[model samples]
Target: MQPSGILETALYVTDVEAAAQFYGGLLGLEVILRAGDESVFFRCGSGVLILFNANKLKDRPKGGLPIPSHGATGPGHVCFSATRDEIASWKSHLEVHGVAIESEFDWPNGAHSLYFRDPSGNSIEFAEPKLWNLQ
Candidate 1:
């Protein structure tokens, strides 16, 4: 059987507070949990977005849970679903918050996408669901 959907998405950041400010304060994602300086969890619709401190998790002691050690370097990417109106609004909102829009364009399918970066330099995007022919 195939997995239904993603429950969580993660991105590694150098600083957790900066991530919290960007994702929670700027993007308006509700802060669900905070794990000291290691990670921050945000509620993004039905799913969760987690930002982990890249340096902190590198030597994490695996004692309590079966979760394995994981980390990533450089910039990662995540795209959120948004309609045309919402995408346009997001462009203005982000700019007012000093977030520079890296690119804004239409795909071959005519779906519009707006791209920016998070505090950790991870590529963030807002695109129409039709980008993948989804509703």
Candidate 2:
């Protein structure tokens, strides 16, 4: 058997609070959980987005099974699926909140996407669902 779908995606951020404000406040994602200053979790349509404090997790003691503590330094990326109409609305909403739109792409298949950075500089994208389907 093979994996059916992605359940969660994570990004390393320096400040959990600022990440929360950007994901929850600006994007309207629901803050599902917060692990003190270490991490924050947001519910994103059928999946979970985890914002982790890289510095904090880097020093945590290892537990059984040798599970690696995941963290990153440079910008991470996560893309969310939206409808064409929703993509347009998102552009307007982001502008209203003063979030800069870094760039936008129109795929040859006619799908479009908007790219922007979060508080910790993780590249976030919202693209039309059709962008991911096999042409």
Candidate lDDT scores, in order, read 0.94, 0.89
lDDT of 2 at 130: 79
What is the per-residue lDDT of model 1 for residues 22-125, given as tens digits with 9 covering 90 to 100? Answer: 99998999999999999999989899999999999887876988897887889999999999999999999999999999999999999999999998899999
How well does each candidate superpose onto the true structure, as a TM-score?
A: 0.97, 0.92
Maximum-TM-score candidate? 1
> Where does candidate 2 clash, by residue pair?
none
Taking the tens digit of each residue's C-alpha lDDT, what string does model 2 give over 19-108?
888888888999999989888999998899999998888778777568666677899999988887888899999999888999998999
Best by lDDT: 1
How many clashes in each structure? 0, 0
Candidate 1, run of 10 with poorest lDDT: 62-71
